[model samples]
Target: MTTESGAGARVNCVVDAEGRVALELPAPVAATRPHLLLRLRPKKGEPVTVSRTVPLEAVADGPARAVLEPLPALEEGRWDAFLLNGPDDTAPERLRPGLRDLRALVDGHLRDRPSPVAVRIPYVTKEGYLAVRAWLRTAHAEAGRIDVGDRSTTVTARLHGATFEDGAVVRLRMRGSDAPERDVRPVTDGDHLGFRFTVDHEDLAAGTAAEGGIWDVFVHPAAGAPPIRVARLLDDVADRKASFVHPAARAAGAVLRPYYTLDNDLSIRVATG
Candidate 1:
């Protein structure tokens, strides 16, 4: 919440391939029995917080190092980082981002891993404070490369904590409507799937009555399993709506655009003339 980093407590975080966070802190703060506290950013649901104490050790002349175990993963949300100076410290100070090393999360390192996929990425907030982005899903379809063609759009995604079945398909459901869902069978390769579906501009325009509306995307991995929302949340980028822009395809007096929602989920929008 506070814009300025408090108490000059800067932290450099290194996230390993297994989601372990190693923190390098200044010697003065480390000597105070420092504890790391992560408070989830307020949203529509109940608030959550995770706190862990740092084990102090003599570092000779180097900065104090502590590791935050990855067990008991955090919930899916943005968490603000705070540094509690000691056990008696009631008011924890917000930490500033020093250096973030998150290369282990690139290129779907955790793909094909066990069930209940867990991903945590450390990032600097817009307010100049250190925070973390966490995602926990029983089954997830991570949206990858997207190609917007004149007649259709192709979407490639990697599946985690789940596998594709015989009847796997991608579904595009119009928001707030009783319109029938549009389903497209995808090409599956190992743990990856590619969806090439026609973007029926005319039907979209008619569905929304010439007014633009959103179409949420989902992937049904198996017949019995529930459909998983298509999203992109593997790397260090906390937000992708502004950075990942797609070209609009215009046809039949309608304009179709694919975009990522505020929560990084993939969706389509249709506008009519």
Candidate 2:
């Protein structure tokens, strides 16, 4: 979970290791006996709200603080948290650190009831999107190193937290306008796994009118577990010192580069002459 606080007021919060939320606020705020409100709304569906007016003794030191534990644990989804002055208070002034850039409903009469006050703040999780995640008991696939060549591509990887037989079927999942999917049998060397894929330079070019030149690498473990993304786990390479540079691409008047996106999803950039 990500930690956020009120922008105008002195407040800080973090989700602890045990999944409990710890909030710290100014001593003055606690003296006033103002209520602490927590509102979580998923991107879709109904919202969850909780509130309390903690005592000053709850303050660890000079600053006042409190901890909130979800009764049954937060639901699985992208959740937005709001630390407000009152329980479900719609007053603009009562708004604290929350989502900003939300346009005020210009036509309030268009709704069944009054619209809630707008908060002009932006708060996000550590990954920039607050989400309740669920992890599987099975192992996860990790991408190791990629070997990019003029005619083919090779991927080195490992399965963390679980092991499988030598013949576990691995595949490369690609998503784009065309949405092409390919299968490859990875050769296992002890704990390390290796896969090779053929590439067509002309078909990967810009003039080919081929769908978006992007592929999302994915792997399916043999134990019938869900597929996982093949991402860049190795150290990022500098542009000038990329390990998989292809001189043939330059001679062919084309560019083929593989990299990880901002979200750490592995992708390849193929541009034709």
lDDT of 2: 0.43
Write candidate 2's Cα lDDT for 176-270 as tens digits. 46555555666676544344344444444533333335555666656565666654322211111244433334314566666665434466665
Encode model 1's per-residue lDDT on 1-273: one tens digit a residue.
112344567888888888898887755554446667778787568555454455644366767677777778878888888877677888888889777777776755344556687878887787788888888888778887788777777787777777787787788888884855777777788534444344555555566545667888888987766988889887666788999999998767778899998778899988877
Worst 10 residues of 1 by lDDT: 190-199
Residue 106 displacement (Å), model 1: 2.5
Local distance difference test values of all predictions, in order: 0.75, 0.43
Question: Judged by lDDT against the true structure, how good is candidate 1?
Answer: 0.75
User: Which model scores highest in TM-score?
Assistant: 1
